[model samples]
Target: MTSGYLWLKAIHLVFVASWFAALFYLPRIFVNLATVPADSHAERERLLLMGRKLYRFGNLLMLIGLALGLWLWLGWGAGRFAGTGWLHAKLLLVVGAIGYQHVCRAHLRRFERLENTRTHRWFRVFNEVTVLLFAAIVILAVVKPF
Candidate 1:
């Protein structure tokens, strides 16, 4: 691999890690927010603030990661990997991750408006999606089976 490509890959990995951390944590905040009583407005507000900040940071990370991935794919001859099918699967999972990020943003908005209705159990389940998706993505990228 070219040095330039390696650098881009490193950057991509950094941002992917940052975004996944946010993805993993944001939903846990939601789970906590869901359980907080309406009377505990202070705690609720604090979690909302954290969620908003995390969402912004996560969005930035996602953008940087995507940009670096594009550079690797189009600028560094990563097209050669296209025939392996793993890259395609990775791309699809990345799309799912983006969709999951959007859902988190929507939930953040709902919480901001004091309109969230989902139970803590629901959010706990939702939080697990990131774990599953990230694991699958890592496996596809590393194994490249097929």
Candidate 2:
């Protein structure tokens, strides 16, 4: 409840929210990439470049956010909550979010290699997964309903 704790929490929330923005949009980019006409090389390349840049930016944000969160938990004594069921569940979902980000990278690679076989509709569905994950994480953190 100290000022330092509040500041760290605020910064951590900022970076995490920024990272999620990238997560939410990247799949929509994938949907567009998937639907790009096979002959539209220029368009595909443009989207790929955007995706690559966004992915890198998102990675940086995620790293900073996670580092700050770790500091808040361990250094700032939020570790008091460590053994609680809600904290455990929240951590698991964080792991899932990381995995989801990497999965997006894999899809981007496939698209870059012109090996993507999924439809735009599939990518649309995939995009919703991030939303669900974010919602669950927020609920776990705020509600802490064990």
Q: Which prediction has the highest TM-score against the true structure?
A: 2
Model 2: pairs clashing at backbone N, Cα or C within 3 Å: none
Backbone clash pairs in model 2 (N, Cα, C under 3 Å; residues 3+ apart or in different chains), count: 0
Residue 109 CA error for candidate 1 (Å)? 1.2
List model 1 lDDT by residue over 68-109, tens digit each. 888888889987898877888899999999999999999999
In Å, residue 130's CA in model 2 sits off its true spot by 0.7
Where in model 2 is the C-alpha error above 4 Å?
A: none
Q: Tens-digit lDDT track for model 2 on 89-120?
A: 99999999999999999999999899999999
TM-score of each: 0.96, 0.98
The whole-model lDDT of each prediction reads 0.92, 0.95
Candidate 1 residues lying further than 4 Å off, grouped into runs, are none
